[model samples]
Target: MDTLTHTQFTEAGLADWRDLAQGIHARFATGDFATGLRFVTAVGQAAEEAGHHPDVTLTYPHVDIMLVSHDAGGLTPRDLDLAGQISDIARDSGVSAAVEALVEVELSLDTADGQTIGPFWAALLTGSTDSFADGQVRDSGGRVPLLWFQDTDAHETPRQRFHLDVWVPTELAEQRIAAGVAAGGTVVDDSAAPSFVVLADAEGNRACVCTTDR
Candidate 1:
């Protein structure tokens, strides 16, 4: 590939905000050239199946590899999932190297309006009136950064950027969507497991609630 310039980097930045994620990298070495070629072939098969092609370079008995799921935008559960599988493949081939690559993403969105809006979610999730301090509520799980609710003057031509994908073993998609609707969120779409219902807050900002099991 050609060298990327600063201008090119700036112009090619992510429009969806998910492109800032990091990928995975693995290094492999073998005593013989044939073993290296075999390793490359095995990696190719895995990449094709996962739909994630890894970067690879080989010189006789040494190969360097890097992996990132560019389609997912940022490092996500999926990226790590693929990384682990790749590690297992390397181990099976008698090639050993530290898997030194992982994607880390940090985000902070402070919307003046979101602060006021958070009370609604706090109430919905907790099943009680919001007792948020200064209109801020927090939800935490794993390495996920804080999802904030800020307070803004006005939103023009509202649209949903982030949504939730709630999973349940059974197809309770409609019922769950109703619960959100009952809690003051508008159900924007319920068309199509791997399905989602787009939603909007009382102020018309968008989010989605979906379940893969459905």
Candidate 2:
């Protein structure tokens, strides 16, 4: 499956789901454990039928779902189709959609020599460098936040070289940014608002609030 661009996905209008950096996420309020299990069962059946499955997380009264095409490295039409089907299942089960409940966080390392540092991070994070060949480090088990290097020219001055890349639903970007500001965080840059906004805490360390709305 080929990767879908942000515009293509946004144009598709997946109202029932939210696109995050890691995947498409949606939460269904199942009301109880049994109800949630039933919903998961239905989702499993739908996934089996479609030959694709989502990563599901069950909390009491809530079932969170995430879908991404790992091979394609992003969202595809298959994800959209499955999201639609899952929406149908949610409707049939009398579940409510909770779009605000999902977010994805990734770690980013700024380095001029990722090829050299990549191995160390992969080994420290995942115990192997197999995921380091392409200058991005990921755990094969998907158990850790992805660490990708941001290319930067060597600087003479020392600065914070690590930060978080927080990915959230498009609709929630502003709200999240505002919340961060209210929490004593400052928006250092919104030149790329909605797509990405750089924020810094009171101490001046930077992180980004990101969305796929672009």
Candidate 3:
């Protein structure tokens, strides 16, 4: 299946879900464990019927859902269809989408040689090298943040080489960056602004606040 571009996915009208990072994320309020399980069951049946599955999490009062075509390396029409079905199930189950529950984390490692270090990070993080590809590594279980190498020339100066790339809903990027600043973090760079803003802590450790608002 071919991957759907961000614009195409947006045009499909998935108001109940948020496109973040590589997946479409949604959280439904289930009210209780049993209700959450029931909702999950319904979603499972829907996914089974569609021949596509979503990454689902049931936590007491909420069920977080993420849909992506891992094989396609991005979202596809199948994901959009399943998302619509899932939205219907949520409505029938009386669960509402929780936008605040959506966020995606990715790890960036500055390296001069991605091929040389990719395998080590892949094995260390995922217990296998099967997820290593295109200078990035992802766990088979999809539970951990992806690790991607950022190529840079070797330098003798000591500095932080690893940083977090946090992708959140576009509307929330500014609020998040403000919260980080309020928490004593400084804005390192905002040339990219809403798309991506680099922030640094007191110790100079950097993390980027990223959005898919492009």
The segments of candidate 1 whose C-alpha lies over 4 angstroms from its true place after superposition are: 1-22, 98-214
Worst 10-residue lDDT window, candidate 3 = 154-163
lDDT per residue, candidate 2, 57-88, as tens digits?
88888999999988788888999999999999
The digit string of per-residue lDDT tens for model 3 on 25-128 reads 99888889999999999999999999999999889989999999988989999999999999998999888888876788999999888999899889889888
lDDT tens digits by residue: candidate 1, 1-214: 2333223323433211111212334456665788888888887888788877766776686676655544554344444445566666777998776222212222323354665556765565454334444453433222233344434456554434344334321234566667778999887666762345667779886655544223
Candidate 3 stretches with Cα past 4 Å from truth are none
Candidate 1 Cα deviation (angstroms), residue 91: 1.5
The stretch of ten residues in a row with the least summed lDDT in candidate 1 is 13-22
Best to worst by TM-score, what's the order?
3, 2, 1
What candidate 2 gets wrong by more than 4 Å, as runs, is 156-158
> lDDT of candidate 2 vs native?
0.89
Cα RMSD of predicted structure 1 = 15.5
- Best-fitting candidate, measured by TM-score? 3
TM-score of each candidate structure, all chains considered together: 0.35, 0.93, 0.95
lDDT of 3 at 103: 85
